[model samples]
Target: MSKPTALIKFKAKLSRPATPKGAAWTFLVLPAVASAKLPTRSMVTVEGSFAGQPFQATLEPDGQGSHWLKIDNVLREAAGVAAGDSVALEIAPVEKEPEPKVPADLRKALASNADAKATWADITPVARRDWIHWITSGKKAETRGKRIAAACDKLACGKRNACCFDRSGMYSKGSMGAPEAAE
Candidate 1:
């Protein structure tokens, strides 16, 4: 005997009691369980039918080990099932997965710089990435060396907020001076 494959699509409704009249259910339900094998990343369309009118929905990975079913259209139209109504979610496979969050070090590198005012203002964090890319993207030592001193100097001041580890890192305002000698 071989494993069976699905031919006809089916609707799987949640086993929840319907919402009371004129009430709002504000919550998110994740990764609906079904008999069909839902591939991790696949393009899928889910349809909702109410009062003989139908609305189509899109389902994608919610990035927390579950799928995000978009109910934008269905929610707007008058339907038999309320928000908490035991709605059925039908699915198909999709092609792409959600993008991952940036690592802490990368975020620190992007957000902190010693020249807290100027360099930070010049570019958005995404743009900072380009600068980071240009500086670190280089394969040659001299090219990287050229930016070393000024970049470090700017960061050392602890004033810049956009490209260093600490966005609030600030240099003390104390003065560095010696008594003047009079002739």
Candidate 2:
């Protein structure tokens, strides 16, 4: 994929989470100046180049009004960079929204309910993203299962969006923030 003309550009050192909560992933927190240039202080999709490798991702809010990018193992390998490496980045919000992959649990729930499945198929990709985000945002397995059930019930009732979900996590009780860096 071609890299978009960068609206924001900076160099940041990647870090790993101190706790087990997000240890599987590496993260880079955008500088305050760089993060401020993005469209919103919320989760937003952007197509960017990390260490010269092209990638598209949804940046998560850091709860400090800045956003942080999660660098998966694949990207890290491809980019030839790892935690503690300061790599160059260039990013811009995607003009066209990308569809989020449906989790297996949610997919199974929707498949079993004809009404929900039909509604899911009819909703726009953006709406589908909201539902998926709402479901996946749960911190526990039980919470996720409950969300899947709730999602199906709401979809069956023709709800087009995950009502009142705080995509930004700024106001929600479960405020999504960047994980603390490992010492």
Best lDDT among the predictions, by candidate number: 2
Tell me the whole-model lDDT of each prediction, alpha carbons only: 0.38, 0.87
Residue pairs in steric clash, candidate 2? Answer: none
Tell me how far the alpha carbon of residue 90 in candidate 1 is from the true structure, in angstroms, after superposition: 3.8
| Per-residue lDDT of 41 in model 2 | 88
Worst ten in a row by lDDT for model 2: 1-10
| Candidate 2 Cα errors over 4 Å, as ranges | 1-6, 21-24
The TM-score between candidate 2 and the true structure equals 0.86
Alpha-carbon lDDT of model 2: 0.87
Which 10-residue span in candidate 1 carries the lowest summed lDDT?
174-183
What is the per-residue lDDT of model 2 for residues 122-154, given as tens digits with 9 covering 90 to 100?
Answer: 998878988998898888999999999999999
TM-score of each: 0.30, 0.86
